[model samples]
Target: MRSTTPRIDVVPAPTPAASLVFTTVLTHGPLTRIEISRRTALSSAAVTKAVRPLMAAGYLVEDADEEARPSLGRPATLVRVDGGRALFIGVKVTGDEIIAVLADLCCRIRVARHLPVTDRDPGAVLASISGLVQELLTEAEGFGVEVRGLGLAVSGDVDRAAGVVRYSPFLDWRDVPLVELASTVTGLPVTVDNDVRALTVAEQWFGAGAGISDFALVTVGAGIGCGLVVHGKVVSGAHGVAGEIGHLPIDPLGPPCHCGNTGCVEAIAGDAAIIRRVREATGAPVTDSAGALELAHQGDPGAREAYTRAGEAIGRAIGAVVNVLGPQRVIISGEGLAAYDLFAEQIRDAFTASAFGTAAQCDVMTRPLPFEEWARGAAATAIQSFIGIDTY
Candidate 1:
């Protein structure tokens, strides 16, 4: 008798140029073969050869238009990834909840699910993730496509190569082999990455940072996290801690951070920090970000003061990033944008005061991305894995 347990079939050698072709279409898709060759620096024959298998495998498709022509006096048919091809599972684990999605190969969310977590322990979180993935896997069965991989996006220092969660402060987890555990439980290949970097990958491929070679994604929420993409690649420092701008020391007398530093960006700008400062200033039991934002919107002096300081701290952090990397743009994101109106002016003022010369010219903008988007970013990581691209 055959074993009853369902299992994920192991993928054979994924195409070599699959990564180059996939990445080309991911960042600059709907392009002709000629354009793909030009962008990826692959020869035209190579692009066609690389794309043929993907098209045959249903992962990519050519546009219907047959009349489009390149400037070189040649008819060029555009090619794009099929968003409905193979499905994928992406999960973003936070302190309070798990956000999961069934995304396509092109990283579009075909379905989404969320589960609240009262427990931060690894076992509990893994149980939650397994249940969610099972649900998505059942959903994919309806679409008649395999769920290729599972991507988990977590906050803090993560070694993507080692597939370990080194230290996640919010979850109180240390040295957890999350990828191995999840893959075992779900019977699917897994890719785990830092939440901010995962978000950066999605942005680089599909969102605001698309086509920009150098840009920064600064997340302000429970913690301050920065993801830097320079020269067309996200920088993961040699030690797996490249853009820890949250821990960058800017003030010596500021509140103490969990990292044992004072006046770090997170210490001043994180949600907990803002709440602590608000309670101290107003003598009110402001319990959460919503309460603080309400007080500030109500013209409460103390609440307004807390946000003002937070804005200044964040702006200074952005200035520091600009001073060092000189990115073409800095994107301010996270759940913190709900309070952006309260501190937008202060952020601009502090950034202007702190930025030096040409660095100040770097575009600073706010973009609100929901947790689903972050999870979709996790799916992006799996796509990278499938294409055999380098990942952190």
Candidate 2:
């Protein structure tokens, strides 16, 4: 009897140069062959070779730019990725909700969905993800394209190579084989990565970090997370845990962290920490981040103090990252940005106080990325895996 399992089709790039060429075009295209070569640092001949197969595969398309044509030369032709060539799904598993996006080969989000996750059990999360993927797959049918892959992004220690989520404190999960389980249920090639790192991939390719060689993405919300890009590559430490700025112990006498550390950045600055502090300080029935934020905005001294402290912790954490890596820029994002007004001044002051001489020159800016963007980041990871890029 014949087997009934669906077979996943791997995209054909065939060489590192091909992958480079494709990425260059995807990120900075409708470019002429010469522009692609210049951007990728590949020889014109190599760019031509790479483009040939991709265009033949319908993954790339070329168009004549009559207006861009030089009077003395052949009409300038531009090459770009064919976004409709393939489809992908990206899911971001947060502490309380699941954000999923249906995207194309170019990583453009076609649709987004959010499902509140009341249960954090591994089985429940997997089932939610599988259902989301099926919905996305059905949506893909309308585009007449196959859903090529699925990407899952979770907070915490993720071993992308091993396809396992080693530890996810937010989800109270440890040693979970997420990729295998998700792939088995969805029947599509799956890529699993740390949520922040996955977001970094999207930033590196298309967001504020684009065209920058070294940058850091720091997220503040339920958790304080950092994603580092050095020499134009996302740094996944040998142990699959890098840019863990949240766990950096800043105050010896500070509050205890779930990671078994005292005065950690997250302990002082995360949403839970802020809420706890607000409740203790105000003696109010502050049950959630929203209530705490409202209290602060309403001139509650205790709540304002809590935000100030969190801001100080976050600033110091960014300073530590700048001191250590000297990235050109640090992009602060995540859901916690909702309270940026409450802590902006404190964060700046603390960062200035902690950063050493030249490191203080690093630019720090905030960009509020919705959960959909994070899901799209997950999709970007799947696209990277499909194109044989080093997402890890």
Best by TM-score: 2
TM-score of 1: 0.94
Off by over 4 Å in 2: 1-8
Error of model 1, residue 87, in angstroms: 0.8
lDDT of 2 by residue, 1-392 (tens): 11124365666765888888888888888899999989889999999888888889999999999999787988889999999999999999998999999999989999899999988999998888888888888888898998888899999999999999999999999999998788778888889999999999999989999889899999999999999999988999999999999999999999999999999999999999999999999999999999999999999999999999999999999999999999999999999999999999999999999999989999999999998999999999989888888644
* lDDT value, residue 321 of candidate 1: 91
TM-scores for every predicted model: 0.94, 0.97
lDDT of 2 at 266: 96
User: Cα lDDT for residue 124, model 2?
Assistant: 94
lDDT per residue for candidate 1 within 1-392, as digits (tens), equals: 11123343322235656676778786788887888888888898888788877777777788745566656664667799887777889999999989999998789899999999999999999999999998998999899998888889999999999999999999999999998888778888789999999999999988899989999999999999999999989889998888998898888999899988788989999999999999999999999999999899999999999999999999999998999999999999999999999999999999988999999999999999999999999998887886678744
